[model samples]
Target: MMTNSSKSTLSRGITALVFLALVFVPVIGSRAMVQDLFMVLTLLVLALNWNMLAGFAGLVSVGQQAFVGIGAYAMFGGVILWGWDPLPAILLGGVAAMFLSLPIAFFTFRLNGAYFAIGTWVSAEIVRLSVAQWKALGGGTGTSLPKGTTKDMFGVPQIKDLLGVSSSAAADALTYWLALGLAVVTLLAGYVFLRSRMGLGLQAIRDNVEAARSVGVDPLRLKALVFVLSAFGTGLCGALLFIQITRVSPDAAFSVVDWTAFVIFITVIGGIGTLPGPVVGVLVFYILQRVLADYGTVYLIVLGLIGIVIMLFARKGLWGMFTEKTGIELLPLRHKSLQRSER
Candidate 1:
């Protein structure tokens, strides 16, 4: 009988080793490989935040793109208008998203279930349309970061000094490291939260809100906390994403599919409510993306079909199926006792 803490410690050790290895990936891997992994890490962060909110908090939001767009636009505005360093602006973008989420939460919290979902989506659309009219950011047309500004992104100079690389190479290295940090933070934070007192309360609410409230869980406060936290991570990811692209447009910044839809697909297919689920799901998604690249929109159709099959056959998701077959928890949020004596 190994304790959950022992298991978590061992897992953390292994994860640390893996993280160390990844830190060196940018050193040996080609620029393209780093770039591709950036996409994976970014999406994984988005998926993790969404999974935490929906899977743990029972707040299924479809309008997360609003925060994503706001984050990106904030970064762009900071760089273009405020003349701030890109790095600090990225942090500001997250702050801006957190602030935006407050009022939206106050409004959307009034609705429940499906109405909440739709209200969130409508809020996102309104934001996209409003951002589209800001002529300074090229209004509806879109704009790209000047080469000078891109090259001068804060930390670029320091990174160049340390790595002895060109500006473009330094940029990639810096962004790759940031992506790596964000992904790790998301995973650790989610796991920690799920193992916390609030995590227990949230799980109770997930199972039965009335029961949770009866026990003094304070469902509204817990839900609001989760919502604000989700906005922060999503907004940070959006800023990092647009930083890589070095350009922004209303459509691209506020893209529902890229920011929200794919995230949902990854979480749902991976096994909602499990830490390893999103990680495995993102890997599976990338594999499918590579294989189905030439098929155009058919890849999406196939995703839908797979989702339906999973729902019908294994409602808990692929990781859930795996867990049912073998009781292994890569990131354990649930405690178990094997023997009655131990119990």
Candidate 2:
């Protein structure tokens, strides 16, 4: 009874559920394996958020670190200063970052192309300088987080018995699981949003804002929504980063390079505007990082060279090339009605 189009939607729905399940699997299973898993998940979220803004929305914001720092500081403030719980503090940080992006969106949405990028970069620097000067939160020196409690299943000690893992390891693993869950959730949200009407508006706007406007698409609102959404995820990633480090300094909190470099590289290498691009990029990048860990700057230079090569050969990127060659999207976000002829 199901048509091909229905089949594609069903398939996508199933995949989304599976990805989310993968994110939480570590939480119930074991803690020793959580840290690395979480880090990868966080990176995946970061890459995808960046891709959504730059790839789909056509807004290449170079100053996303503004939100990143805000998120980190929010968490740091909650846990360290207000004596709030870590989890709640982390969530608040992400929310605060999203809210903070609204004003930036209003200001920068008027500019187009390279000018927009410049505006964002300048804004980020302003945020950085302001945070740096705030001595109340340790200013540039950074502050540390207090140790928090851990829970286990059936009222057992999570680290000692329920997971059969060491306390520190268990904590690290839980953070990883949280990051993974967020990444999966963020991806699913993007997938669903793109499949809906708003997503069509976004694609339309991206293709040609003037035409989209003629078609009744509000480019400003769409851009603002995507901008805040991107900030939300990036902020979440920053909060997670703070948890992992248990310390926050203006320098590290607003590390522009950390937010920009890997994400741009990942999105570019994986495939801009494609769901699987960030995942592919992260896998390739992690491999390269591991293999080249000993070489320091040389490793970075090599990564740059590889990125250049990929860009030069396939302007569309690795995932784009794969999509072109195979006509299959492993993690397709855009819902297309299947044509019998193509089938």
Candidate 3:
């Protein structure tokens, strides 16, 4: 009979194998493949962060692009104006977004339900408009990193020297590794958080605020902290994403559809309130994008139809559907135990 500990061990073993496969993908796969995976991983990070905010914390923000924009611009400013290194500037970008998220969260949290969602979207637009006025960073037009700055990006020099690849290839490889690291960290951190006391409290609050409050869950503090953390992680993803593109513009950086809408759709369709949901959602989304991108408007219509179908039928997302059918959780977070039968 498979006990809980044995099941956990099996899960961990499978996870280790998957991790190893991802880590070596760049070595064997084409550079284009690496870059594609990088994009997928970044989107996965966004979906995960948004899921945490909306699914776990009950803060259904529709303006997460606020952080993504600011984070990208912050990294741009750090590298262009302050001459900070690229990778380090990405970290600073996350910090800047976190700092900004406090005020945004403070104001938006005053409302509830749809009002809160609109308020967040409005705040993000306000930020996008304000950022458009900065002339030094190319104002409304946008800007690209200096060639010299990009050539020496973080570990690219070493990567180029070691791999005997061109500067661009080496750079792609470095960013691919960073994206992999970020995805791994984000997934692991989320799993750990969901298993913690605070995470349990957050879920209680999400289910019933008044009851959770009565049970000693500090709803206000918990919600605010999660809001800021989600912004921080989203900001980090935005920074890293633009770093790979080597360019930034207010419009592109703060795109609600690209950074917020797609992420929300992916999360909801993947299965909210579950860790593996975003991972599965991103992969499915990426595949659809690859297959249907040539059709443009038709592609979008199909995507919408699929989302509607999944939501109406599956509701729990692909992973959720699987678990409902098989009772298997790859990364189980619930604090429950399986008791052995007494002989």
All models, RMSD in angstroms: 2.4, 3.8, 2.0
Q: Report the lDDT tens digits of candidate 1 across residue range 1-343.
A: 8665576577769878988988987787888988999999999999999999888898899999999999999999998999988899899889989999999999999999999999999999999999999999999988987677757887888888887778888899899999999999899998888889999899999999899899899999999999999999999999989999998999999999999999988888998888888887888888899999999988788888877887788766899988776555687776556654542
Q: Between 1 and 3, whose lDDT is larger?
A: 1
| Model 1 steric clash pairs | none
Task: Give the whole-model CA lDDT for all candidates, comma-separated.
Answer: 0.89, 0.79, 0.89
* Clash counts for the predictions, in order: 0, 2, 0
- Which 10 successive residues of model 2 have the least lDDT summed? 148-157
Candidate 1 Cα misplacement greater than 4 A, ranges: 1-14, 336-343
Specify the highest-TM-score model's number.
3
Candidate 2 Cα misplacement greater than 4 A, ranges: 1-33, 147-160, 333-342
Give TM per candidate: 0.94, 0.88, 0.95
Best by lDDT: 1
> Native-vs-model 3 lDDT?
0.89
For model 1, the run of ten residues with the poorest summed lDDT: 334-343
